[model samples]
Target: MPGASAPPVERHGRPRNGLRVARVVARDFDGHSETSLDPDLRVFVSDLARPYGLELREDLLRRGVGHSYGEMAEELLAQALPAGEPVDLLILAFSSPDVRPGRSAAVHLSRFCPGAPLAFAVCDQGPAAAFTALRIASDYSRSGACRRAVVLAVEQTSLHHRPAAPVVLPDRHRAVALVCEQTDGDEALVRQSSGAVADSAPAQVRSEWAALGPQAALISGPELALGPQAALSGPEPEREAGLGRDPLGPVVEAGPGQPFTGVWTQLAERLPAWRAERRPVLVADLDRRLGRLSTLALPAGVAP
Candidate 1:
């Protein structure tokens, strides 16, 4: 086990963000191949949908076509979480509804996971929910309420009912788990939420990244792409990837099909390479309908 408490201070010539992410892992699921939902879930969804004059479709109720958050978290944790490693906090963030309804995956995960830490879920805020979870985890460590935290961001493409308006869904089932731990540094990770709305999100994201120089990168979600041109107004990534381009460095975005897990998936895939290059990273995501924007700024070369 790692040290429990470490003051947030600059260490090793690097501005230590309050939280050091020990591990980051993500996976994309092809067609929903999980077992079928039991009778309890079907009854729950059927009653819930009655209010909108919607009934459960036979296809939606079939097996091999849906996902359970609990199941997905289990898989990710198995890959990222070490055996018998105690966790101080566990948070689940998702934009899509899990196949198993009326059950809290976070709480359920706590029971099987080592430490049985405080657990909960954050949702309905779209991509910003993950940032919110990260911010909360950082606050817990800073306040001395926790020693380590795990944040699970999961999104499934299955929506059993029709929406009043068109919604952006992920291309496939995907989930990312971030094991964020306290660093003995005296500084905190940069996290901001609710300031930028749908209209201003792009400008804000661009300005923030523009100041990071070549040792930095910004990975953003599709929600921030609401403006005329969401891509950062800078040179190609090949140039800014330490090749000498705009100060904004490189911009990686979640695609339209992956409205929720896009940015996170990108981060999970590219974190290692960026860490090797010693580049600090920023993740900015938004809940366009809610007009809320959130950003998570990480120090260079975060662990694992």
Candidate 2:
């Protein structure tokens, strides 16, 4: 799991298309030990302006679940990268505050990759930061600035580290790693829309689905709790059943800590299934806190 330092950074031309998706791996840390929201902890968070003490908060923390976000990211990198193969770029996205005073999870993760790939951290946008990271990675890869970029998105319960701001909670700790390379063709694309237009988000997303065709499935992020009526409005109720089902799964919900990384983690797991069904998958993540929407549409066979 150790190698030479990352290569010196280089600049390159901008290719027209986005990155060609490669290996994808995800991990979920759920265990038997459980942590409850005690009264003293509740008192510490009594003045914040976000949803706390929600039903899912207790559900997110389980017994014996122990792993920091950086450790999870390292595990993911080990799974995504081959031995001694250095990554050209590393984009680590997470919402929690850094475990160390001056270091970030990205910095901790860089230890796993021997190369001096231009590693950086993306934050301050919540789960939507993953979309921002992808955009930067795609632009870097397309511009020929680098090759073989790895994106690691991680989220863990704030049971141990409490922040003042609101966060989305999930069933457990999770991380996702996407190994991307430079390629040109019709492939997976990520689209992010800014401004607080929550009302119009559904309609715009519906239009994107129309453009992608009927085979596209809609997976809304935890921040985006769009119902079928709000997300899809057409004559095909039966076809829209996919939207009615839990996009990521029942265990994942938007509430306490950052759940955006779990969105990618879930995508990594189910992408092959979507490809097998011969359908293009569209993921819509709305930053409910920031009124931003990040969407990704990947063509079949990108991962499979």
Candidate 3:
């Protein structure tokens, strides 16, 4: 019984496309924040969370400043999207709850960004939202339906509509804006990936590592459960704050602390170094619940 194995993972991929990440910006929110939901909207929020088995903070709903996707997206609007930069599509991807459940944060955000880009949100996909956003962006770009796109992967720590679970919320409020542009460039390459499971993560990661040259590196999210497999491949990993490297390649990891945003945030932080070193980077994260895995292969060097 102890030796019983899990089901095999369904894996498939398409050939590379022109979708390249032009820029990546990650923001973390702390302390009290401004309000995006109006006072009059309090009544609308009343008991709406009941069906989901969540408890709402009545006091906060009435009059209080808390983190919100709309508000956060508003602040990131300028930085995430530059002034007068035309965007054809905007997507807000998140696993966490938004303060104003009544509002569409992505659609509202489009008003402040450049151009009348089609705006929408990708939620309830857990951490896979980032990957889904990239895939969608790629599809749009490939079909020539959109030239430029913005994918805002956001998560807030404050769950006003509290959950019964012990601690399902992220440690911090994080928003990662990925600007994707279609061009004949040698960078920001993203390949569509599907069917990721714990049983297959290590082998999948190793296969990805095998494809990269010595200079290239692979960073896996903590949730993928690659550490134990990593140990078998090489020396025990340094699992305190983050993951350590193995001999097969630069197999690093984002700590489990950040949960959803860890790997993406790490990509934002390490992109410059990797580019400067002329080494490609592959970032992988797995949704244990859905048994799905997403990998973003960012080529080395700036796009032409």
Worst 10 residues of 3 by lDDT: 1-10
Task: Give lDDT tens digits, candidate 2, residues 1-304.
Answer: 0111122234454334456566568877664222222333333333332466323233323332334566667766777775757778899887653323334557667777858688888888866777677777877765566667888877665544344564445556778887877666535566776676566665666555545553333433222233212343335763245443433322222233335665566567665655566555566667666777776666544324
Task: Mark the regions of model 1 whose C-alpha exceeds 4 Å error after superposition.
Answer: 1-17, 30-35, 62-64, 186-190, 214-247, 301-304
Model 2, residue 66: what's the lDDT?
36
Tell me the spans in candidate 2 whose CA falls farther than 4 Å from its real position: 1-17, 30-66, 159-166, 214-258, 301-304
Better of 1 and 2 by lDDT: 1
Rank ordering of all candidates by TM-score, starting from the highest: 1, 3, 2
Residue 288 lDDT in candidate 1: 57
Per-structure clash totals for the candidates: 8, 16, 0
For residues 1-304, what per-residue lDDT tens digits would candidate 3 score against the true structure? 1111122223354433456777788888776455635664455455666667676776665555457788777777688776668999899998876766567888899898888799988878777777777777766665556788999988777656556665556778888888888765543433333453556655666555445554343333211123122223334453321333434445556666566777778777766666666566677776766666566666554413
Q: Where in model 3 is the C-alpha error above 4 Å? A: 1-17, 33-48, 52-65, 162-167, 185-196, 214-245, 301-304
Predicted model with the maximum TM-score:
1
> On residues 127-173, what C-alpha lDDT tens digit does candidate 1 reach at each position?
76777788777766766667778999998877776666777767788
